[model samples]
Target chain A: MRVGLDVGGTKTDAVIIDDDVHILARTRLATGWGVDAVGATIARAVDLVCGEAGIAREDIRSVGVGMPGQVAPGSTRVAHAVNLGVRELDVTRTLEPILGIPVRVENDVKAAALGAHALHGSGSGTMAYLNLGTGVAAGIVVEGQVWRGAGGSAGEVGHISIDPAGPPCRCGQRGCIEALAGGGAVAERWGRPGALPVRDVFDAADAGDALAVALRDDLARGVASAIRVLVLTADVDTVVIGGGLSALGDRLTTPVAAELEAGAEASAFIRSLRLRERATLLPAGSPAAALGAALVGRTTEEVLAHG
Target chain B: MRVGLDVGGTKTDAVIIDDDVHILARTRLATGWGVDAVGATIARAVDLVCGEAGIAREDIRSVGVGMPGQVAPGSTRVAHAVNLGVRELDVTRTLEPILGIPVRVENDVKAAALGAHALHGSGSGTMAYLNLGTGVAAGIVVEGQVWRGAGGSAGEVGHISIDPAGPPCRCGQRGCIEALAGGGAVAERWGRPGALPVRDVFDAADAGDALAVALRDDLARGVASAIRVLVLTADVDTVVIGGGLSALGDRLTTPVAAELEAGAEASAFIRSLRLRERATLLPAGSPAAALGAALVGRTTEEVLAHG
Candidate 1:
């Protein structure tokens, strides 16, 4: 058996899976802030999940935690997980002795990518999980293994500038994909307070508000560009869109598809790619992140060097 | 000994290498039009290179050919090699019987990427070869193996639109990296007849021509965008610029480096990536394409699957 945890900014999701990857138990808890609190939260969640699974802690073979941050390749230390309010944390050191299990850590988007591939991929090709969260990023999985690039910055597509005149990005560029499509960027551009700012923007666009309509279009354009980048650069078989904004479902995917179709209409090269058919939305509330964490915990080596 | 051939639009470069990858002999010949002529061209090049090496053709273990076209994964058939005046050709069918040796085919840019990594890469890290040819494209090599993406369009970064409002591309897109920096596109934009139109544009820009200045800056911008795309999407350890236009050397790399530096100035995030340091220029007349072809010929399996 293996245990997995998705330590999010607001919540911690836990799962217990058997050898065949069957989910034996699942639980969620509100996440706490900072290092020690976060560690304690993981411990509590682990215990709760074990109880829910009706198994002793000794039954678990390994634990994996996925979070929004930089997890160095082949290491359990996470850094700059701003969303989780974690500056630095050694996940193995924090949880291994307490749980008496081997521990591994991976970036949340990467873990989700692995899990999504397991659930939705063709089982024999490359897939990119494009996360549209507070910041935009992607995680690529090839043949079921997450691509852990040099310096661990692979799939930082959010910073690729698509337009010189588009918009100012917080990353100091103009017209970054994240600047246009990220949930936080859109909310800031909308200048409106709402629990679901992206959903509100979509609703206002439906009502024919000019700015809302423009933001909505920009979101679609950014997403379409990201799809093109993923296909052209990595040539993944499909792009699975997930993240907070994905909750909009068809409201988001429809326009993004339209944007790709529009580009295809103008360019025969783009038309031939049949990009629209290759993009799909990850079902909302999928346990991909935690499930992927469990899978990751089982890998002996996440890095490969070819001679 | 292994034989490698770069069957270009105008010239066919051939090389013979020993088991240690040491070049034994190198020769070039004018390529012919049509399928039969191309087949004859390869045979002639092989004979000529073997003579140059003072070795018999029977000693050759395998022959790998790299050309501009679409090569399906693990296949020796090439499609849409327009510059070579061939719509479709099965290289293995045409050459194997003639040579009595195993023949492997690969895209020129992809071959060059593998070759460049072998020559200039850190050997164990990922690298991208950005080919600034008549059209812009990139080939990514990870751990010394070319990343042949699903469906074999893995490195077609030329069509990625970096500026929607900047310029129209032959691919029917606006502001594609190719449209801005491609040798063909820039010459078309310049509308001047010159053997080396890109170099002419650079020289004219140095002479203070307004149109030339704009075109030159666009080339730099396009190249910079391509480097960024490679780094951000694939996180290549370095981007080695090659292809026909790379002959401009410092006139090309200097401005491209400046463009990357300019982006770093605007964003601390860009600064952290050290993109300028990662961008490099392949040496003039480097045998990367043919060498990479030779390397590809030796691989028993270019594909992998994980479960």
Candidate 2:
């Protein structure tokens, strides 16, 4: 049996999977501040899942962890994760001694991409998974492996400057896709007198609110522009959109696909080649990061054994 | 000994190197229309170099050719090169058969990056090479390997949208770095009645022409914005500026450095990290693309053999 744990800003989820890849048990818990509290929460979740699965602690071969941060090789020490309020936390040391199993750590978005890939094996080709939630980020899978650039900073689709002089991004750049189209940006643009939540903004747009409609279209354009850049740079066949805002469904996918079609026709080189447009929308499951993390551990072990 | 050949828009260049990597001989010829003419020209250049080095053709271990287009793996088939007005040209089949030597073909910009890596070797850690010439493109090298994203379409940095609503780009996009900051853009902007060549714009800027100064600063801003995006995506230690336009030394580098520094300060996360600021403003020698192409063959062979 293997365990997957996804740690997010609000919650931590754990899933126990048997050898046949069936989900045996699952548990969720609120995440707390500080490394020790987070570690305790994860350990408790793991224990709960293992008990529910009717498995002893030793039966759990390995644990995989996913979080928002830069991870070092073969270690759980996060190099940097600004939103998570943690830096250089020795996750492996904190969790491994308590859990009594080998652990692996990876970037949360990367884990999600892996999960998405596992669900649709066709994504083994050059695939990009974009997350448009509180922030916009991407995890690129190239040839069935994550293409982490130097220092694990690849697939930062959010930071690609779409507007040189537009709104400032959290990354300190001007007019990044994130600054203009992320969930926060959508809320800021549509949250009028009542300060509507991001999800409600989409609902209002569906109800024909002019401001919300415009905001939705603008977000779609941003997503489309990002897709165009990805195509031009990676020449990937599939693009999977996940994260909080993607729940809007057709409100996001239709316009984004139309934009891509328009942009492709604009370039002769792009026009010469036929591109396979994979699913524009996909649900990365609520505990996708944790599942992806567990899969990472499983795959890493497989690769190491075979390699 | 290795040979480097650059097949450019107007001309083809070839350089021969000895075991010690010293340049032995160089040849230049017009790049004719058909593949046969181009192949013959390359063969003649190789013969001339071998004669100059007083070595038999068999002694030349490998040949590298750089073309202005997309290259397939293990072959010199030009997938698409708009500048050369050629598509799907079988360069390796044509040239290797004629020259009776092994040939490797790569994108010109990638070759230039390899050349820059070989010559300067300053940014040996994690480096990027941005070529601001007739067109603006970039080649990213991470840990001494060219990062060919999913397919061979990884380093089309020029196409990243800078302005979604700005001027139309050659790639059919609007407000790409190429549309605003490439050599053609500069020429079009300043090539008014009685206006000098694009090279003279730099001279005029040096002479304190206000219009020229503004143009130079704008170019720097554009390049700086691209650099900022690169930093966020790649987290490289250094960036090397090459191509015909990089001759504008500090006029371009200083402002770009300043802009990036200002951008770094906009976010606490960006500021907290130790961002490397090593920038090289140097032009590769004439025929750098060809030399870089040759180096590609040598490097790839070494990598394959070792792996």
What stretches of model 1 exceed 4 Å from their correct place?
Answer: A300-307, B300-307
For candidate 2, write residues B1-307 as lDDT tens digits: 8888887777888888765556778877787665556667667777876786687889888888788777765556776676666766777787777777887778888887776666654433567777888778778775445656555656566776677666677777677777767888777777654433456776788899987776666676668755655655555556778877776666567767776677667756555433425566766355556666767766655634431
In model 1, chain B matches the true chain B with a TM-score of: 0.96
lDDT of 2 by residue, A246-294 (tens): 7767767776777667766887655543332644677535555676677
Interface RMSD of 2: 3.3
DockQ of every predicted complex: 0.82, 0.42
Q: What is the lDDT of residue A201 in candidate 1?
A: 94
Model 1 docking category:
high
Local accuracy of candidate 1 as per-residue lDDT tens digits, B186-258? 9999998999999999999999999999999999999999989988998888899999998999999888888
Once model 1 is optimally superposed onto the true structure by TM-score, how far is the C-alpha of residue A282 displaced, in angstroms?
1.0
True contacts kept of each: 0.85, 0.54
